[model samples]
Target: MKVYNTNQIKNFTLLGNTGSGKTTLAEAMLFEGKVIERRGEVENKNTVSDYSDIERENGSSVYATVLYAEINDKKLNFIDPSGSDDFINGVAAALSVTDIGVLVINAQNGIEVGTEIHSRYLEKAKKGAVIVVNQLDHEKASFDKVIEDATERLGKNVTIIQYPLNEGTSFDSFIDVLLMKKYCYAGGKLEISEVPADQKDRAEELRAELIEKAAENDEGLMEIFFDKGSLTEDEMRRGITVGLIQRGIIPVVCVSAKKNYGVGRMMEFFTRVFPSPNDVPPPVDTVSGNPVKCDAASPASAFIFKSAIEQHLGEVNYFKVMSGEITEGMDVVNNKTGNKDRISQLFAVAGKNRTKVPKLTAGDIGQTVKLKSARTGQTLAAPGNNVVFAKIDFPEPKFRTAIKAVNESDEEKLNEALQRLYMEDPTICVEYSKELKQTIISGQGEYHLNIVKWHLDNIFKIAAEYITPKIPYRETITRIAQADYRHKKQSGGAGQFGEVHMVIEPYAEGMPDPAMYKINGKEFKISVRDKEEYDMPWGGKLVYYNSIVGGSIDARFMPAILKGIMEKMEEGPLTGSYARDIRVTVYDGKMHPVDSNEISFRLAGRNAFREAFKNAGPKIMEPIYNVEVWVPADRMGDVMSDLQTRRAVVQGMSSEKGFEKITARVPLAEMNRYSTALSSITGGRAMYSMKFAEYAQVPGDIQTKLIEVFAAEEKDE
Candidate 1:
């Protein structure tokens, strides 16, 4: 392999819907560049990009695979990511690091949900794109219909660069508008041929439209084109390149990746027309808020876009050099972890295979072995430079489940394996909910979680089960109430004796002003100086008042009493959920100095608060999430009806492109297995995303059932 300069490198990411032939297209491109002697098929599980066990089993790409090929002295790095929504993080990460996106579309199924989703990402990233209409040889393929559908959804910026001369089962040749020639595949090779007489007029019309669109990229070119009625090949190429980089034109190309039809011409366009690495602007430094130029002589800085764990290779981290040159043996610091690490080895990766490289210059993508602290989305810079690049923003997990080891002895192994898996795919979130006392694993959907479960059992020899996660409901008071308790224990040695009188009330931002209250026909005045408010770490507030004016309870015992009250707050008196947003006033209490230690006062405080809580109107608050569902317009009615059954409040509805977007707020408990249910209802055509919104009181009927369930569980334990 030969080293190429930054200007000679072109980085692109292949994205589209599952079964859109992106992997096969990449294979064809690699074969055309002579990087591989033979093309591999997904059905045979021998493709360079989809080589992982999970991918082979699912017959789809799971992880983003990187491969490079040299064509016309230009190094083109192709990042092929999974098209399924379950692995959208891979697509986002690839887009963040690459300059151009090659969106492959199935000629038979044009502008599906996945196509719209990826197109949204492309627009958000403000990157250049080229549409590749693949699978032209399919029986139902319609080149003209696909082009029209694409233009309708993607807008007028889409322009045709090539079209199949004989599409559908007989797709053997395509006419190139830019070159004014026809490319035919015969005898296992591509040969230049003259345009067919029957399609000559159609080809000429498309060529004229292409010239006009390309000329619009520059004023000088437009003037020249208008004066001469056409553009030279060199001038047209320059104009198209500029238009692509500026996102003013989205060139459409046709190909039959499996048959290798028009693949060589596609490679030629990639090498000569696509934007190079230098065409992309530098990224801004996250810490200093300054643009960091891609200069080989500057301090070394790189961003890790993807990380994976291989059986024999351990951890392989793939990163793009943002600035300066990274050489083997150089020491760098992980900005996120602040851990220093030495680069022991560097290699240019082609899927799972790697070739050792002495150095990787700026704008080049390469992989490195075992960095102690480096992970996905981390920025690594030379020590003392202190440069931090912005991290890759990954979408939040859409589904969650509680995971527990099947065997008691495998708990430790399960935890270690989960951590390793998290390092490999940052989208897999493993959280230990301290309140629920369960380990929750969240991902894109049910299938994603299942994959993780498979890894746990097969790779780590630890079997685990997934269950619906328990909702972290909160307990709160609604009314004011007072209660008194006397903890008098006459156990033989050191008898405990203490008495506490507390008033419980609903808490808000500003309330509970000190006032006079009478206890047993006696008037006691509470002062503002004895009140304090505590902001609980979990979520809510607790306002405590120590108003013992006559010295009935010692000042030293107040903390002990507060600690007891907090303990009860953590495990609420009703349903054992965390309690929040309440006010408690220990206006009157009696303590025997010798007998009333922390334990006696603690028991008194706990009993008094419990009694007051029972009198105060307590309600359960469940977490609610704001969910947005994207589905085909025809299925909107069915999806909306299903959401209503789950106690969702439909907030709004809108239409984008050809899909209906419904926004709603639904309780977390009602969303169990929602991903699966939605898939069933929509036939896998709809997708939804959700995030934490707020907490609201559970319905009266649901609250009654929940309390009963909690009581039963507590009795079982």
Candidate 2:
């Protein structure tokens, strides 16, 4: 393979909805570039991109596959990510390295929910993109409907670069407005000629619009277009590149990747006009806060975008050269990990096939293995350079479930496999929740986790089952209460005698200290000598006051009392959930110097606090998430009704792009399987994201049920 410089490289990622022909389009592009002798079909499970056994079984991609093709003197690197939203992490990983996005849209479906989602991601990433209308050979393909939907959802920036002259089942030709020519595909070979007389008027009209739109990118081109009302081919290329880089234009092209029609022209546009790595903004060196430009003369820096474990290969890491040139047999240091690694070999990847390359220049993407330690989002740079690229901002998991091995002995092996899966796909998050006491695995949706389960059940040969995860509810007081307790135990040793009187109250910020607390018509005065406040790790505050007058209880025992109180706080008296935001005052206590040790005081304080919490109107608080859901306008009512059943409090509703955006606050317990429910409600045409908003008190009936359940469990244990 030949080494290409940054300017000679065009890095792009294919984006679309599932069944939008993205993998097929990649196969066609690979064929056109001569990288593959024959194109592979996804249904046949012979495509180079979806070569994984799991992918083959599912007939879909689950991870980002790195592939490359050469366009004359220019090298085109393509990262084909899965089109399903469940595997959106693939898209994010691809976007992190690629300079532009080639969004393949299925003409039969027009703008789909996945299309809208991927487009949103592209825009949020601030990357330029081109729209490819694929599957024109389908009998139901409607190019006009696609164009209309793209204009509406994609904004007015949709520029028609190519339009199918004969769409639908007979699709074989298209008019290129940019070139003012007609292209026809015969026997999978492209033939270009001047626009025919019958189509000349239509071609000229579209070309005029293209020229005017392209001219808007540059002041000089705009002036030329105004003066001569035209733009030369060379001038238009420069204008389109600028417009694309600035995201001021979304050039739309037509193709039938299945039939190999117009695929070559798409490749031509990629090589001729797609923004090179050097054209877009540079990635920042997080360590030095400097933009790492694509400069071969600078220090070497390669940002690892994805990682995987192959059948034979122990571990493979794919990266894009952010700066300088990296060659085989080069030593690099991961500043993030502080681990020195050697690039033992370099390979230009074409799916499962990898060709040895001498070196990869800046902006090129390649893979290397045998590193001692490294992970995705870490940068491998020349020693002393300390270049660390920022990690991709992946969205939090929307679906979560508790996973456990059927055989308890296989838990360790299951955990190890899960860690490997997490490394392969960061979106698949795995953790053993200390509070829930279960291994929680979260991802995009049910399907995403099912794929993970498939890996464990097949590849790892481990049996695991997913259980409903326990909600991390919290407990807090709703009223003030006071209690007193005396721990008197006469064992074989010294007698243990400790008495504690504590007044507990609901904590509020900026509230006056309790000079006196009146409860049940009884007033108790406290002379606070010292006080301390703590920010509890479980999500609230703990205020402790030393109100012992005249050293009634020694100061050394304060810690013991607080520790005991914290034990009760951790295991709330009502429902065993972590308790928060309560102030406890040790107004008065009695202790025997010889008998009252830390244990005695701790017992007394624990019992006294537990009693007070029970009388303080203790309530359960469930985590409420601020969820934002995007659904098709027609299905808004259906989605809304489903949310209502989940006890969601609809906050507001609005319109975003061409979808309805509904925001609500819902209890995490009620949202356990919301992703699956929403997908069913909207016929898989909707998506939503959730984040922790606040912990709110549960309804009285629910709280009562939770207490009863906790008591029953406690009794059983």
Candidate 3:
């Protein structure tokens, strides 16, 4: 593969809501570029991007697809990503590496969930973006509404570059504002013609707006536009490029991918004006804490943004070269882990296949095979450079389920496949619960994990089953009490006996100090809490003073007692939840020289802790999260009302660009499928994100209900 200069490379990600024609547009681009001999439709399961079995079955992209197109002397790297929130993991990862974001909007639907969802990420990425209003040939298509939606939702930066001469079913051509000419699709090829005299007035009006916006970016162009009140085609083209590179303006183009109309023009626009890697900001500090800047002339340094497990290729690490050239057979250091590995083969990916390349230069995206130590978000540089790229912040998994292999024979295979999938998808998380002894796989939503299971069964041939995840509810004490127990045992050897008495009480608002626990002759007192400080129990140990003043209980049995109490704390006495921050003092006790050894005392301590727990009041605690839902202003009232019904506490509301950003705290237990619920309420037009804020006390009734349910489930399992 040949390396392209920064200006010769056009890297962009195709993004938008499902059914927005992103894949279709991508196919048209490929077809027009002649990269593919023929265009494949999504409905036929032959599109280049959504080529996976699941994607074909669903007729939507399930992962990010990489394809290349060399058009007009420019090499374009097209990242076609899935738009569903379930598969947004791929979209987010794609945004991390791309230079431009092309948000496809259905001319009929105007703006949908994906339009709002991906726009936020693009804004955060600080990448230049263009709104592609596609499917103009469809019946009842509303290009005007889409344009209005684009301007309303995307902000004033949006500028029109083309206007449909005829819209909807009549849509056949577009007037190129930059060229002041009409380009019509004739015989599946773009043909330039003079602007229609009747439409020339409209064309000039649109062209004037375009030129004014373009001129706003350059002083010379602004003076020319002001003096002559018009801009030449060449001047407009140069001005658009400057505006795009500076992210000062976002150009819009109308296309009917179904008719393959305007695609060639879109390609021309990208090759001529789209910003390149050198025009975008460089990668900053990665999680490993090293900053890397793009330097085509410097030693090799690249960052892997995505990884895939190919049956024949093993591990393919897709990366973007930020500095100098990286060649096959050259050793590179993983700045993250300080491990060095040789790139045995480097290739440029085209769909599922790869074109082997001798070297990949800076600003170019490529892949290396069989690099075991390399993974997404890791930086690779010439040995010892220690440069790292910026880390991609992955969204938290919104869904979870317990999974188990179909048989013991496939357990290891299942584990291996899941691990590989986890490495490939940062949003997918898998782990085993020791207490439940079951593996739980989690992702953005139910559909997300379903795809994982599908891959595990079909791709890796490991059958598995899933169950609803355990709520992770916890138990705590609400009141104080005391209990005592004695352990006496006699085996075939010497007899053993030990006794313990401890009191259970409420912990302070924070953590319990030494004063919280009191040693007494007839009563024992200790307090446990549910606050952050109490969460740190100093390894579940509390020092007991030798206040006996006369050695009431021998010091030899204290360690055994402390050990037993710690063990009991781990296995909750009430409902098997870990106990927290309570002090146990051995103020008074009895001892037998021969029988009161560590083992006897340990048992005594465990029994005593259980007794105290039974006497004290117990409660349940649920996890709470801070949720920020961004919705249209018109839907704010409905969203807030719905949140109230879910027992959410609305913190406040703020305006964000064009949406209402509402912040609230809600229990995680009540928000398991809030994404789906929010969609239902907003008709799939709202977007939300949540993070674990803090844990709060569950309501008394709900707490009791959860405890009962948990107890029943534990018994059934």
Candidate of highest TM-score: 2
Q: What is candidate 2's lDDT per residue for 1-717, written digit by digit as tens?
A: 889988899999999999899899999988988899999999999999999998898898887899999987889999888888899999999999997888899999999988888998999889988999999998999989998999999888899999988888889999998888889986666799998899988888888888888899989999999999899988888888999889988999999999999988888888999888988888787878988888889999899988889889999999998888899999999878898889999999999989999999999999998877889888889999987888998888989999999999999999999999999999999989887789999999999999999999999999999999999889999999999999998979789988899999999999888899899999999888888999989799999998998777899998899999999999887888899999999998998868999998999999999999999998899999999999999999999998899999999999988899999999999888888998888899999999988899999999989989989999999
Better of 2 and 3 by lDDT: 2
Give me candidate 2's TM-score against the actual structure. 0.99
Off by over 4 Å in 3: 217-239, 285-291, 490-492, 508-550, 554-557, 581-586, 630-646, 652-662, 676-683, 706-717
Worst-scoring 10-residue span by lDDT in model 3: 525-534
Give the TM-score of each candidate: 0.95, 0.99, 0.90
User: What lDDT is reached at residue 700 by model 1?
Assistant: 91
Clashes (backbone N, CA, C under 3 Å), per candidate, total: 0, 0, 1
Please provide, for model 3 over 229-314, each residue's C-alpha lDDT reduced to its tens digit, 9 standing for 90 to 100. Answer: 88888888778878876777889998998888998889898888887777766776555555455667877888888988776667
The global C-alpha lDDT for each of the candidates, from Candidate 1 onward, is: 0.87, 0.91, 0.78
Clashing pairs in 2: none
lDDT of 2 at 653: 99
Ranking by lDDT: 2, 1, 3
Cα lDDT for residue 47, candidate 2: 94
lDDT comparing candidate 2 with the true structure: 0.91
